[model samples]
Target chain A: MQASMSCRPKWGICKMNQDLIQYLLRLGDSALIQGQRLCEWCGRAPALEEELALMNVGLDLVGQARNWLEYAAELANDGRDADHLAFRRDERAYRNLLLVEQPNGDFAVTVLKQFFYDAWHLAVLEGLTHSSDSRLQGIAAKAVKEVTYHLRRSSEWVERLGDGTEESHQRMLAAIPQLWRFTVELSDSDAVEQRLHAAGLIGDPQQIAAAWQQQVERTFDSATLPLPAPACHFYLSGRQGLHSEHLGLLLAEMQFLPRAYPDATW
Target chain B: MQPGDLIASDLGARAAAPGDLDQAWQVLGRVMDPEVPVVSVVELGIVRALAWDAGHLHVVVTPTYSGCPATEVIEADIRQALEDAGFRAPQLERQLHPAWTTDWITSTGRERLLAYGIAPPLGSANKRSLLGDNGSVNCPQCGSAHTELLSQFGSTACKALYRCCDCREPFDYFKCI
Candidate 1:
């Protein structure tokens, strides 16, 4: 919901307690899955500095995931802690965007994926900073710094790959169509978003979508990449626990230990 | 006063009276990391030195990473802890170099980290970075030399994902500086 200048502590508490676990999960899973994708480049980056830089971005996303997941756990209020929410979720239960879970095909593809997500995420985070809910506002304030850097890093790579050699340009161009179909879901306002918006836990999806489109167009212009034609929405329905095929394998790898040794603590 | 004499006086004064440093260490150790309540500031290796000089407590803190968000919260916690310990307000300064290293982690701290479900740093002997060409990192839990790095970054910037072959657990090892 859009933040108003009027201060009502009662509303803040009530609004903060809104059940937006699905919405928060969307944020958390996007970062968590994308962090996994970025980690694929750990020791294999084309350049050493670039390796550190890429890992840096990956770390930021993982940290962001932890923050959002913790909040999501609170929002769920079913005694699920952040660890439980993150590690115990089934493949179908993950609420990440389709683009984030896509395999990191190549450096160009990874950059394109990041550019798209960062543009949307940064705008969303910026909007959240004014939330009537203090916790979300606090989290957003901290995340904005990290997301800003992430945007800068991805933007630079987009430019380099788009304007570099012919091969790189072609690769960058190809990566766009591969990921562009998934962008539509980012703007799709559904029940969870509606609840969050009414409670002032989040901004209107339309506003975020408009800002995202402008930023995306500007970045594409700079990168010399063209926007893909509009297509049917590629929805994964991660909020309702429906997901693509990739999440199962990811969960298998991530949740193996905890599931195998149930209730085991260090 | 000669520079060396000033340094010696400072060192002599330090040796004669432990000052607020020992007290500060004890008090600050009680300050938990805001995000990870299980970890203390000392365990995080953020509080590098606690000195009592000019009738005030000086705490030199090195951030976990260049842009770690917890620094401000940690600093506030440190000040509050010291104030609670009877110093009106402590003087805090941040030091960035010889940057804080996971190598500085105490043995007890390492054990705590493992118990907390995050892997401890590989010993200095086993630690290497991409900045260098040595690919040796050990699993802190099992002492298995057969560990592979899963990710250069982990849940946080200060960590790396590592999988131990012997124990077969993927963990976030606090990365070496």
Candidate 2:
């Protein structure tokens, strides 16, 4: 049965594999981009403790990215490995959410971005734990534990900044409008996710979105920040490879080393 | 069948001779975690299983953290240790399911962590810790229950920075994830 499936590339099996690979890329690329953005705060964070926290969270994301990318490469059955998929791909080929690739504007902006992403991340990972794909289940199970801690930390920061001093509150207020539009991609799903979900290999988009919305609203209420109207009309879709200008710049710096030294190795 | 089941069946293809599995376990026991040299990987519960496959020793290991920098180093160390102990090119498999948790750390491992001045994970990693309520971590140095969390993240991904109020000393607490 396994041999027959492998030999038949034109069958539904190939199509399912392709969709699975795309979904994996979405998961992997989001983590890689988000981790890179967090690492940008390494030397410039406000305090020593904050610096460690940012880097630590960043490390976890990057690590998770590798796991997803490695699985994607295996299913791809192409010559490209995880490193090649991560560094060699151009901006349009990347599948990370726009929220992660956005530039780290300010402390308030970063915190809000993280808070929103963490909520969605936890929901998606928890759903993935029950996936029919055993490899994905394992990966998601591991990530859920780490992301649980991440969500707690980021949500606490949202509450702290939103309800703290006057300036802090104002900064968070400004951040809401700036980043809220990008979150449309979080709840939005396309054909790839639909196919995977139908195959029982991924989570239901509506359920994951509902859980995400509940958590975000709860946190915002506690933080005393008004829940902005849903920016559903926004059409930015990172999974479809439509990215903002910021992603190209970020990728330039990130891919420079590998691109410049294609043959270099440790 | 599940992928794990496939691995299990393959492992059953050739059972290890008596004492081979025991010898491999002993070799792995001597192989310590690179980040925390005091505790062996076996003690840390990262080494999940040892089996024989196709006349070669197969070892399965799980990383403590997803992006733990030490995972590669630890794998290499395990391979080197097994090879040095006369196991030929032992196969190393990285398993991600049944994720590594602090609870896996044996009682002896917890003692080693304490003696090394790192407070063991406080309590069971339950749903409560996921909700921003990590139970109080006691100080490893003075055995003080008055330790305060200095930072959610410490020197490593698996640790949180903490300070003992009584002794006024800062230390790392193995986070209960």
Candidates' RMSD to native: 14.2, 5.5
For each candidate, what TM-score against the reference?
Answer: 0.61, 0.93
lDDT of 2: 0.89
| DockQ of candidate 1 compared with the true complex | 0.06
Candidate 2 docking: what grade?
Answer: medium
Model 2 chain B: ten consecutive residues of lowest lDDT: B1-10
For every prediction, compared with the true complex, DockQ reads 0.06, 0.70
Please state the error at residue B54 of candidate 2 in Å: 2.6
Q: Alpha-carbon error at B39 in model 2, in Å?
A: 0.7
Among the numbered candidates, top lDDT falls to 2
Displacement of the residue B73 alpha carbon in candidate 2, Å: 0.3
Candidate 2 per-residue C-alpha lDDT over B1-177 given as tens digits, one digit per residue, 9 for 90 to 100: 323334444444332343599988998999998888999999999999998887678899999999999999999999877766666667899998898888899899999999999999867777686564766788989988998888899889898899999999999998887
